[model samples]
Target chain A: MNGFKIIVLAKQVPDTRNVGKDAMKEDGTVNRAALPAIFNPEDLNALEQALRIKEAHPGSTLTILTMGPGRAADIIREALFRGADDGFLLTDRAFAGSDTLATSYALAKAIEKIGRPDLIVCGRQAIDGDTAQVGPQVAEKLGFPQITYAEEVNIEGDVVRVKRRLERGIEIVKASLPLLITVNGSAPECRPRNARMVMRYKKATTLTERQSANEDYLRMYTSHPYLNIEEIGFKDLDANIDDCGLAGSPTKVKKIENVVFQAKESMVMPATDHHLDALMKELIINHTLG
Target chain B: MNNIFVYCEVEGGVIADVSLELCTKGRKLADQLHCQLEAVVIGANLSGVEKQLYPYGVDVVNIADDPRLEPYTTLPHTSVMIQLIREEQPQIALMGATTIGRDLGPRVSSALHSGLTADCTSLEIGDHEDKKNEKVYKDLLYQIRPAFGGNIIATIVNPDCRPQMATVREGVMKKEILSKHYVGTVKNLEVSRYVNDSDFVVSVIERHMEKSKVNLKGSSIVITGGYGVGSREGFDQLFELASVIGAEVGASRAAVDAGFADHDRQIGQTGVTVRPKLYIAFGVSGQVQHVAGMQESSMIISVNNDPKAPINAIADYVIQGDVNDVVPKMIKYYKKNTK
Candidate 1:
């Protein structure tokens, strides 16, 4: 496992779980501007898992990769600030509206371009969409075995052991090597940004960020005396243009809507002996208890 | 319009209960659209599965039994599903939102380049007939799920995609009983192009379980305290009340963040959604996210020091007093009632 290269799939998502009146658009799509763009919580958990592996194997290096509109570079910089060895932002106008399938295609291409990796770690699902398809789908596209809902990981000799979270309980599973692990929030919390790493890469930027942040922050990002930003763009990585974005994506959003639950409540009885008996009888009548 | 595909999941050669439940759900959904319900099972010794579909009202059962289907590898499972959907061209696909179903549904949907709705609370079909006399029975699937912290419902439709997919949460719907008089045709499809070792870059060695003592999902009653409950010691008292009531203990997200409870026991959009019959919320503010999960409970009683606490608005009964004071009295009342 020496010199192992780990690639993490990170995303920039609106803080949907904690949104205000300004957080949504008229169409129900998140207003990314009003809501603070935070690193996807699950992706942070994935980064934590990757960092754990790096800690166990000193020679291992972790790189963060993201494909989104250019503003997504903030997620990459956040990752680098947390001790990732490198960051790659796969940005272009073409990648817009890429669903999980198309997103996985572009990411798999990026992973291939980054060279073969020992492992790929991603959050089980992004909070905004909550589809949870991308991680397993990416592993599928990459032709690697994947462990979903990974709560724990242990490596001994050549064998990599993990605890896969099931609905009932956790299942301790082992995948030999070069596998993908999609972590849940239950995975160990990520370590805080290392001051040394923050001092080293806080100013790192993508070419788009450097060119676009055209604001005062852009100057601060580029000229930060203690940091380094190696700008990598679409051309630095080998990818087919058609396969990288919306054109390569076969699935299109027919519609999106806000989901609400209108629930009606009625009571049976409390869990007293008589009420418990009545509840059991009701369940039996409905053929649910027996 | 054609076949309705059902992913019949199996473990150790035995079909899972949820797959059978989906078959029952699919049978009705397909019937409404005037199509045949086709069950797609991938594994060996599927002979019993086909015979068992009759009671569930399945019209046809498709089996792709092979050695590679063993051990539940995502590669082989999704490949088999993709192959079946491409060939059969199901108008709609359904899978249980179990851990396996949640993992597999999206993979197959993505591979087929179709839309998938996850954790659906309800599903129905609506008609969209043209005004002209030439009317075709087109499939209109409406997938309803909770969103906006469960305060709102989102209905997702894939008007253009074939075999529209939805994964349903567990135990939300009832599975129809097998009718004694029903029978269906079961055909075994040959799979020479099954997934092999070469197709897999990594292989699963073994699966272990995590270490958590409480499972809030299965609890009948949850005694959840909130910020008004004060310190962790107050939470401990709530846990004691929970033990006396034979209920699981839960907390609003605030309590969990305050280090009063474990993450699994936290209820809301970011935590588990529960439908317990009796929900006792002590000192909770009833934020939208907190209410989103438990608003559907059979009974809700809120004990808040603040009468104006948001939780009291939706509660069935609001007990306005300090939770530290009121909870003990409620416990005493419950004990007296039980005795």
Candidate 2:
């Protein structure tokens, strides 16, 4: 059977899961600069699914498509180290302040430019903005069907079967080729970086990154063409200027308030036998516990 | 022409609770805006489904009953919603943030270029003054949600979009019946006009939807653990304590992510929201997301090793200790005192 082309959408997000004391500033806003940037957790799961499909189908090529600042190339290199064939970094100043809709527009345009692959895979949502809209929005823009919360995906011939994780239960669905699937966090964890592949892709950098690199990397790019990660900006795609970033996004953040919970009067006690017994007695008397 | 619309989800002929909740909220919004409340239900064997929604102050019920529409597929549902919404031109559209709604809301929003927010914690009708544009939009649906890992609450608005679309989780809004005898008209849609045969590209093969055993939302007392609980085995003690007290067991998002608890038992902004009478948090350093779900509990007890765990701020009683030491002791003391 002939191999199919697959694309995996990914993002680089702040490590919000491990927010420390310093993660928030005095003004009650997130201190984003202090947080370490990492590949979005579920996006790694998506890359793993794409890699499996590529491995299962001979001659299949998997591409990673991500839209963010130039730093996002880090996740692409990370994907390469895990078995992806190549990657595209969609970075431009115009893409800033783009909500899910505008982001999907930019991504759909890039996918069209890359020649609509047979399959597209992405994480259900990004951690920075847990709005799981971009996947289905992109599918709508590309005029393809979508299966979300996918836990497992199996492909045979022209048909693909997907296992979806729902709130109450599970549903197995089948669709033909040329569709999109959003991987759930419940899916298998991505395999760790292979030492051999990491060494091969350690020098892979976008053109912007290559320009800032030292003289040795410039010489290495000439000898190894595959190490050059393709970069796409606003000018590269056929898109209307109004439909790019903030102009394209319909939803606007009217206001942002720092989350503050009202402090309640509390009796503080140490974990001792006496304090424990008294606390239990008080709860039972108050009809709070039995 | 400009009214409020709710996309009611039907499974085995019964309307979803979230849809009814939206209808309740939508009715209020419609009244505030002086518009009528309309509900759209698409499924097979949907006779008399409008009876469930009319009580929620729904003025119009749009039904597209088709055999193929029983189990929702993304394309057909999206097609029907987009066509119906375009014809109706509703000012606001709301849906449940369930698996079906999340999968369908974005597609419809993208098709119509309308703004859509997911898992909104609160929805209010408020006015927005665009200072930069010197424009004022009156009575807009303020979609309030916690973002950036629940560090901040953001209020979003769609000033230019036709239908300000938003999806709220099932338990986020309260469902109330306006009147048992409230009357509304039902408009049976011609399914062929709204959808095409090509829309049925994806088909459901197998399905197993079991009723959730843990009723966190319905329980009066809840015992929750966090990452500090350590491992899957550590959760066993929490279960023992829950069994002793007849409380439901819940977990923080961190605990669920750490594989110490099931995702269904997670109580946070992303998980289930519960307002039990008594909430006992063990080893939980409450992030805003976790607090968002249970801050309304009548009484809260926080047990954490850290004296200044964030959860302690809203807790009625703060016990400084380890979950391993505190849980077993609490269980023992409760048994002794109650007996």
Q: Which candidate wins on TM-score? A: 2
Show the lowest summed lDDT stretch of 10 residues, model 1 chain A.
A263-272
Candidate 2 chain B weakest ten by summed lDDT: B168-177
> What is the interface RMSD, in angstroms, for predicted model 2?
1.0
DockQ winner: 2
Q: With candidate 1 superimposed using the best TM-score fit, by how many Å does residue B89's alpha carbon deviate from the native?
A: 1.4
**lDDT of candidate 2 over A152-200, digit per residue (tens):** 9999988999999998899999999899999999899899999999999
Across all models, the iRMS values in order are 6.9, 1.0
Q: Identify the CAPRI category of the predicted complex in candidate 2.
A: high
Query: Lowest summed lDDT over 10 consecutive residues: which window, candidate 2 chain A?
Result: A209-218
User: In model 2, which runs have C-alpha deviations exceeding 4 angstroms?
Assistant: A214-216
lDDT score for residue A94 of model 1: 61
